[model samples]
Target: MSTSSPSNAISGASSSPSSEDVETIRKNRVLSSKLYFDISDTMVPLIYSSSYDIAFFGLEKLHPFDSSKWGRICQFLIKDGILQQSQIVEPLEASNDDLLVVIKSIFRTLCQKLNLLPKRKTYFGNLNSSSNVSKIIEVPPIALLPHWLVRQKVLYPFRKQRGWAINVGGGFHHCCADKGGGFCVYADISLCITFAFMRLDISRVMIIDLDAHQGNGHEMDFGKDRRVYTLDMYNPDIYPFDFKARAYIDQSVKVKSATSTNVYLKKLDKALEVAGICFKPELIVYNAGTDILDGDPLGELKVSPDGVASRDEKVFRFAKEKNIPLVMLTSGGYMKSSAKVIADSLTNLSNKGLIDLATPPLGTFLCVHM
Candidate 1:
């Protein structure tokens, strides 16, 4: 998330304001600017909390999923530290699915409680009995950047290189098609890739996923779409273990994160070297999730901030060197507040006059800049 204080424009001097007046105005402006960042990193816990489970709490106010499901899911989610205990929505009754129906009703009542009715309505409108179950929709077609645009001219290429990156999910890389070869409404990395490709069609598009998990989602989605390429850097025994897209996998820079940063960085460096040789992509979608952070509640590997920064800097610097447009999305990380902080670091890169918002990712990262 990104936010900035309003510019202290010195308009036609009302006889130049006193120094004290200018100082006072600056202080007020600093205090009033709103805070923005990837709120999902913060709001996810609130959405999963027990307080959110109350029929009355969400009734007319929030999503209308079966209340029972919320309890069932949140228990596992919270117990695993995917969410915080303090974040639970409260004042809910104890019962099974029947009470859940009431909870759904409560969602209608709670719309005003959360101040999200309009956004929900707009979100729902996009649904026509079709949408990803995860609700990660494809970037809209109208907003799609096609090859025509990139070919016509070059605008701030530096913005593409050093700008903030927003890498979404890569571990469960399920594409928009099912394993049985049927259509799945939600798995649309292809949609994202297509949009990027159409816009930067003249340039190679790189999907560099470093989730200790796999990119099964993208593999299925873009396996046949040659315009897109993948470098699945992960372990094979990890969750979502059925990943089989390695046949076409351009750079499978896999490694085990031993109890040493040196080993981890070595693996990451190998991945980068491979990526440089195979694709030299003009755009990169980096999934810099910190589940790899040492002692991560969910991840099996061990990685530290120093290691992560090394990995991040390599990508950012490489992209800068190649002048590649990058769109980094958060894929996954179970640690508390790790994703948001990682996002904040990336946003800082944006403020350095390197990143430009082609389209802001789902977070507060661009509100200040926008």
Candidate 2:
């Protein structure tokens, strides 16, 4: 022990880097990452890919969520002529380096040779990654899927949407920096905001979460950070009742179970009003969930289909009026009708001229300030 020199002691100390070094490493990763792709003027900011659907034998039925809902929504838009296939913007999967910019730990994804449906026996030959995600993902059903597929099919798309883009499959707001839960395997919202701050030179961001349940994930991640202003409207009597995270919300509007359509819309109007007056943000992340529809069992609210459309219009109008770049995410919807409702809402937004889903379809240039 006495023979240990200064250099030897320095080497023998913790091998991990300090907090400041870790932050520098994250920034470096963000700057070098390819996930923040350039949006061409021709492409609409609507981000989605068919691969976002998670179809496995009957295994998908294990959860009430419609894993195929993302594709269904796109189908309605494309088939109904609301949008053209050429207008859609498809994003590349988030690489390990890209995800590391915000996520503390995630499985090294590697999936190959997979099939879907009744003949779909995916478990044995396809799932190559570790199944030891129980410690990270609190939901047991989510852990059943191989870590690779969760990252590839479910989580990566979320990382691509944050500011001024509509990811048809994202809004996994249940995941944070250190942990993941509620079918969310990665902190996409947090990752995107980090990229916005670091690469896009964005100073302030606003999260307008209108999901049925509280967005505990982003709340926990952005706590004590002034750059993000969160306006969360959720049912207080639902899953993820995170009291600690509630302290971080700049505005919280609680819509009780079975609340009527008009009441919900009024509450939303006031919340938007307060949000506009309180803190104006350079970007708005809209978590537009269909779970609030009347028949949605989980959402437990009585809002009609028209109400959902009205809600979307209000938010889109808010962005339009304030001239803020807004990104909408399809968060949670357990029922089969959720897809149709969301598609209808987008059609309504275009009809109102709040967003030019038809006109040459240019993105708001979220990648850079210029």
Candidate 3:
């Protein structure tokens, strides 16, 4: 966050703008943007794209975070007959101004200077070069940064439709308005909620971040914002130990390392109950991360594959019971097996009648192994 004022032209955001002026700019940018478009009822709210999968010449396999997990999850769903390629909605590539609708003006210029958002070269350059893999991995794949693009695709026609969507990628809760960390280069979660607030004519939103790492990014962005209610359930001792952001959490539930599945679910049930009493949100954003699975090195918790499915079902059920519009993002989870687990959870949700989209045949049960 630079010290520059609103008058500075994409130079910096060091100074704050008057609330009324800022809102006006945000609204204007959003209204003029081409990212938001109308979709027919025939297309499924499940958002994904083949470009989301990045093959770094086998370099991605070296990184703990499975970069291709987004495409893999969709592949499994398509293979199991839960979804067809034609039914899924492919999002438009988000442009510079599209991101500026939520982020500060300076970020776009900074990204350009760093060659991070290259115009001449590929959006994502070759990672085979020295230190390139580490550099590219630091910024999440381009697929994960399309939060605003997907939000409009889902929320624009929300009133006439199911009002729920699942972006096979995103939930970059570790990135905020000013900074990016934990492999998150842009604050897509913040951008999505901000766009929803500006364009959807909605005021209240609830973020249910179940990632193993604390969602310090959004917590920081919405710390004092009463309009947003955050319910983050993450491990205490994890990558980000931001005590300041932790204080802002409306509902903070901590599960220690090696915490069993049953105990974790019980806490979530109680948390959701309390949240229902505290705030009635117009929209819910669920960040379903599988990093908490038993064997993950980063998220030291002990949840199983089955437990992950149960966790997702509980969140979907909570939303269904309230009839609130919900959006789910695959936030984190490094291992190769994370994709399979996510696919299984989708099957569970569909079987439970949570989502109206495609499901397995009556007598057939589908389980995908990566």
Q: Using TM-score as the measure, which candidate wins?
A: 2
Candidate 1 lDDT by residue in tens digits, 147-205: 23321211111011111243222222443333211111223244344334433343467
Candidates in order, TM-scores: namely: 0.49, 0.83, 0.78
Candidate of highest lDDT = 2
Tens digits of per-residue lDDT for model 3, 164-250: 378777777787766556766456777777777877777999999999999999898899999999999999988889899999999
Which 10-residue window of candidate 2 scores lowest in summed lDDT?
A: 108-117
Candidate 3 lDDT (Cα, whole model)? 0.71
Model 2: per-residue Cα lDDT over 1-370, one tens digit each = 1112324322333343345544555676677766766777887778787767776555556677787899899899988888888988776766656655665431111111111112422222222333534333333565566677665544444444433467787788887776666766667778778888998788999999999989999999898899999999999998888999999998999999999999999999999999999998998988998889897888899999999999999999999899998888898899999999999999999898887666555444543110
Output the better candidate (2/3) by lDDT.
2
Cα distance off (Å), candidate 3, residue 96 = 1.3
Whole-model lDDT values for every prediction: 0.44, 0.74, 0.71
Candidate 3 residue pairs in clash (backbone atoms < 3 Å): 2-14, 3-14, 4-14
TM-score winner, 2 or 3:
2
The list of candidate 1 runs beyond 4 A from truth reads: 1-172, 178-185, 199-203, 257-259, 340-344, 347-370
Worst 10 residues of 1 by lDDT: 154-163
